[model samples]
Target: MWAAGNVSDVLAAVPQSAGAGNTAGGAINMDLILEDARRATEAREAASATPFDGTMEAEVSRRVLGTRAHGLEGPA
Candidate 1:
């Protein structure tokens, strides 16, 4: 099935009716959700200004080489 369909199935299977007063405690809090979305958008925009290439690869290389590259090593 499609990804959306799978997500819908997973959401539907959650125990929405098992909480106190049959209310779904796991339901989305729109205010908190909106705040999170706003923060994520801001973070993405900030990150777009200073993009790094091969960041993960560089980290792995630092570990393997046992050298302090890209500030990955412990403080002096």
Candidate 2:
């Protein structure tokens, strides 16, 4: 876990925890993006014959956005 603040006293505490939280979240998101890109590349190569209907992108966007909108707080 990432934490930033004074360990000894309350008055001495410099609030950097929120920045730490953002860094941690950004790291996780970058990792997910890299993994998804790799998988997408592999899938694209393997799916040469698959026809693309423009709606597929919209459908996928909707599903992912919906999941985010609802807050995926629990495990799948």
Candidate 3:
């Protein structure tokens, strides 16, 4: 039951998990579980710095992938 979706439960009232704190159930440790969310947030922040906009993607395709990507070339 302790999951990322449990934030509403955590905020609505004192989290039972906070008191549990890796000692009682051993099923979910909030500190360890939240690390994944932290990592994902960091990855998102890093990606935001240099997003894949279409203009750059097209240039890379033209320069690197070349006309091979244009399957119509064989027909035309």
Top-scoring candidate (TM-score): 2
Candidate 2 vs candidate 3: which has greater lDDT? 2
Off by over 4 Å in 1: 1-28, 48-52, 60-76
Model 2, residue 46: what's the lDDT? 88
lDDT of 2: 0.63
**Clashing residue pairs found in predicted model 3:** none
Candidate 3, after superposition: displacement of residue 39 in Å? Answer: 0.6
* TM-score, one value per model: 0.29, 0.44, 0.29
Off by over 4 Å in 3: 1-28, 49-76
TM-score of model number 1: 0.29
For each predicted model, how many residue pairs clash, with residues at least 3 apart or on different chains?
0, 0, 0
Give per-residue CA lDDT, model 1, range 1-76, as digits (tens).
1122224354443353233213323234555688899998889778834345587666667777665655477556
